[model samples]
Target chain A: MHKVVTVDMEKDILAENRRLADENRALLEEHDIRAFDFLGAIGSGKTLIIEKLVDHLKSKGKESAAIAGDVSGDDDYQRLVAHGIPAANISTGKECHLDAHLVDHALEDLPLDKIDYLFIENVGNLVCPVDFPLGSHVRVVVISVTEGDDMVRKHPAIFAFSDVIVINKIDLAEAMQVDPRILERDARRINPGAKIVKMDARHGNGLDDLISALGL
Target chain B: MHEFSVMSQIIEGLLEESKKWSAVKVEEVFLDLGDFTMLGEEQLKFSYEILSKDTILQGSTLTINHVKGTIECDCGFKGEMSPSEDSPHRIVPILECPKCRGPARIISGRECTIKNLRLVVPDV
Candidate 1:
């Protein structure tokens, strides 16, 4: 009573996401906003590093806005707002990473013309975030020394796709018994072109190198 | 964690494709997963099994083909870099050019695609 119904797809599973990302990129470009996707693990200082970068940019008279993605809570979003930076939060609920569609929606709330740079802080996960690009001009992955020296080797794909890699919490290197140089070396091994910077973002150390790396 | 979302996307795509032919049921699905993608096949299948319920894709067989990561470098190095030197339990992949140990452009093995689908259509 039934017959064969074969459908040949040969289509990329992430084609929808990639298409949305391209649209987001074009919109950001039209607004003359340089966007960066800040990717890292939870407690890797991505938020603090962003705070420091915001302060640094403020000193240079450059306005920067942020879009924070997290599973729950508005703590990060509130923190950025306390610093007077225009920002919005996207709660993924069950998702681990932020995709282009969510970002595209968030862009509607952000005042694009009032900012020079747009920072998208992706949900703090290394593995999944690399697969989702949020229309950022540059993608930076942050890893602290507390995560250990093998962090880069453990997640090479993030490093490979990243335009910059920030090695945060270097001030605690002696206590953590991890060398920042070794981490930088391993990161360079995986991605020779990635600009790697060591820092204690909590105290604003090494933010200049990161800023220069972004050409901001 | 993200596997569920990826599975949902596949199911949605399959449903749309089947609708184009007025399929009564989906029989099988063939997927091409690149080695560099790091998406777990077991997890994807588990997600699919649960998400496809009540849909035409229910009870469909999911076949996955792992495409190996291939590299091409300015140093004329072109081949697949073998698995890392880490222990058996911890397999860290080293994706670099074997010849110059430099940054090589990855030419392939980052694709995640739905290749084909088998479906059932009622007689006209």
Candidate 2:
């Protein structure tokens, strides 16, 4: 005879990812590495901000490495390498976001003992990357003024969860008719505890503020 | 999209659970999906259908219980939030305290869990 049974699972779909993330966190802690996960849309200056941060950290006698995540291209990886930053390129194939598992694998490929700060540049998309945590010490979301002042409000989840929100490309805010203050206000409304830093990353503006905000 | 990846996880979990129970087939899946996840129901179903093909879960029914997004603020305000009108997709909701209009912590609507499963097993 066949019988139908109702099984009580109560299983979290992202439980595995969360567990892996915790493991990554533990690994980072064990190695005393400060890792930051960067999330942003394309053209949000995430790469530039990371590049600048790596440069600044290097000047302070701190060693830094990066894991550049993209869908296919290794352009960001090349940029980081061109700057002499040790970076691993992670191609997610068709995936839109970088998960903890991918970061775990990337961590193996890096020189953990030689690194003080590890920057993980996630795939360039705001919405999809919000839910996935990559075992970083802090989660930074970058948004450029060219994206508009309402970018934070439109993508509340990402802003709400981020520890630091970088408002990049402020130099063009006037030309774009977008006020950086408006972006800051929106970010504050969404996540009051998040450190909001406005920057012209291309011109090296707000680097100190960002560094202080990150406590690095 | 990521729904495909998520569905694969669900199927993997279901299969493991079925193996433990010695289930011959899966009949239905009950999921509690939170609004904050921003996962489309259609996309999830499509992913499920595609991923479950030729598996024990083939032809199984998928039921998604959408959990509304709610928040709790330090100001003692607690309730559901409305989607931001300014959102281009009209799906991303404002996550501030409705009363105090300050940043609030998400209490629900981010869940993506498989609460239960209907399986076919041999009579013991």
Model 2 regions lying over 4 Å from their true place: B82-93
Docking class of 1: medium
Residue A108 displacement (Å), model 2: 0.6
**Per-prediction interface RMSD?**
2.0, 1.7
Runs in model 1 with CA error above 4 Å?
Answer: B87-95
- Angstrom error of the Cα, residue A58, model 1: value is 1.5
The Cα RMSD of model 2 versus the native structure comes to 2.1
lDDT of candidate 2 over A1-216, digit per residue (tens):
889999999998876787899999999989899999999999899888888888888888999999999999899999998878788999998999999999999999999998899999999988788768889989999999999877777677798878899999899989999988988987887777788998889998898899999998
Q: Score the docking of each candidate (DockQ).
A: 0.65, 0.66
TM-scores of the first chain across all predictions? 0.96, 0.98
Summing lDDT over every window of 10 consecutive residues in candidate 1 chain B, give the lowest-scoring window. B86-95
Q: What TM-score does prediction 2 earn? A: 0.93
lDDT of 1 by residue, B41-112 (tens): 899999999998999888989999988778888889888864565543443345467788877777777778
